[model samples]
Target: LIADEYIKMSDGTYPVLFVANKGRNVLLGREAVMRKEKMQTNQIVKDDELFERLRALRRKLAQEQGVPPFVVFSDETLREMSGKVPLT
Candidate 1:
């Protein structure tokens, strides 16, 4: 289970939790966001073409380096790069 701020302490401790915006007092609990039997996947493609290209490049670099895909760079990192670096 995972949670953020505003979670009731009575809910018990979770193996993993990430609390953000604590200063502003934002809280969330795993059960509040998800069901135990259900799994949620993010399939929404905000930028499908660009994201696919970046994923392919990341996979190629990882194979060449003989490391895991994330070792080359995380998807989040690549997305950030896309925003910071303009295509030339």
Candidate 2:
């Protein structure tokens, strides 16, 4: 079972308890279960490559239209498109 909050102790620590069959039990501390979620996973694209290509295209279009790049499209919009990888 997953829990949202932990039981705190006197020494500024938290406890995790497991109760088992026939009154068998185990206890672990907060340090044992706590871990940082991996943010830079292999599945995510390298933003620099995608963003650089997008910015270059935007700059070229802006120059042709005689306007600033933001007039064509914002970086955030381009980043969202990169994230979605939409075809056509």
Candidate 3:
């Protein structure tokens, strides 16, 4: 896991556990990961069938709960779920 904190000395940084634990890659901040996830979602949401199905599902769920579709689930979340289809 990436540990985020302020450093007392110079440079001002904490540490990530990965390098110490033999993990090769270091994914930096939450914002960076979110940006990357959004990029991946772009590809999934482009699928016509999946998009339509999720749109319908989102509408139905929102109506049942008396809330907006976006409140039920954002397009990105629906796209991510669509990408991982037949979820278990």
Whose lDDT is greatest here? Answer: 2
Task: For residues 3-61, write the lDDT of model 2, one tens digit per residue.
Answer: 33343223336654544322222244323344679797444444767877998999999
Work out candidate 2's RMSD over C-alphas.
11.7
Q: Each model's C-alpha lDDT? A: 0.64, 0.64, 0.62
Model 1 misses residue 15 by how many Å?
Answer: 40
Tens digit per residue, CA lDDT, model 3, 21-79:
21222233323222234343236354669878989999999999999999999987887
TM-score: which candidate is best? 3
Comparing 1 and 3 on TM-score, the stronger one: 3
Q: Flag regions of model 3 displaced more than 4 Å.
A: 1-46, 86-88
TM-score of each: 0.42, 0.44, 0.48
Count the clashes in each prediction.
3, 0, 0
Q: List the pairs of residues colliding in candidate 1.
A: 5-27, 5-28, 6-27
Please rank every candidate by TM-score, starting with the best.
3, 2, 1
On a 0 to 100 scale, what is the lDDT of residue 68 in model 2?
100
